[model samples]
Target: MQEWFVDVAEHIADGDPIYLACEECGQVALPPRTVCPDCAGRSLEQRPLSETATVTAETTIFSSTPRYAEETPYTIVIATFEEGVRLTGQLRGAETVERGEEVRLGVESDGDHWLITFTPSD
Candidate 1:
């Protein structure tokens, strides 16, 4: 994982999710960076992320390495927050979801690792 992702993980672990925002262009980045990818601006701020997001895309995984083989048929989702930040996370506690569905963003522990987690909000 990238070092910037660790910062996001830390915030998620603390129950305070955050994202990067370009102070110059107002572009939000989930996997954050020191410089804005959109405008190449150097001033970035860590901003709190919204609790809810809309599902933009989804996929079902049926095959994986041994570590996650048993968790086959799990759903992964790409969601976009109102701030225009997009993130990919595992959809938990829901068997199926649709594009445009609303989800609540969160973090969950999977064994010794922390993962981005999402659940149906509507």
Candidate 2:
């Protein structure tokens, strides 16, 4: 797990927000990809992501999920970036975040890993 976290941090430090690319089809996907759903490609490329986006959807989880008790009722948001990449992550620093709200990327350390968060745009 430590190695995984290190890798993730390194990846984030090297290039972020990462994008997904299909090696077989040479198609560039805005959000990072594990395998190309369109082409079944096993190879992928991680590319830098645009910093700005708009919230498309959001939900707050109040249940006692492990590792997130302090952040219960935390906002989880899906955002579509200016580059047309759609991604989901925790929404931070807002009591209420709504759809179509502008957001920006913020990084948070989770002890084990660094996770991305969306903050309300100023």
Note the residue pairs that clash in candidate 2.
Answer: none
lDDT of each: 0.85, 0.73
Reference-based TM-score of each model? 0.91, 0.71
Residues 82-119 of candidate 2: C-alpha lDDT, one tens digit per residue? 65667677898887798999998766675756676788
Model 2 local distance difference test score: 0.73
Q: What is the Cα root-mean-square deviation between model 2 and the actual structure?
A: 3.4
lDDT of 1: 0.85
Per-residue lDDT for 74 in model 1? Answer: 89
In model 2, where is the ten-residue run with the lowest total lDDT? 1-10
Q: Which stretches of candidate 1 lie over 4 Å from their true place?
A: none
Which residue segments of model 2 deviate by more than 4 Å? Answer: 1-15, 23-31, 40-44
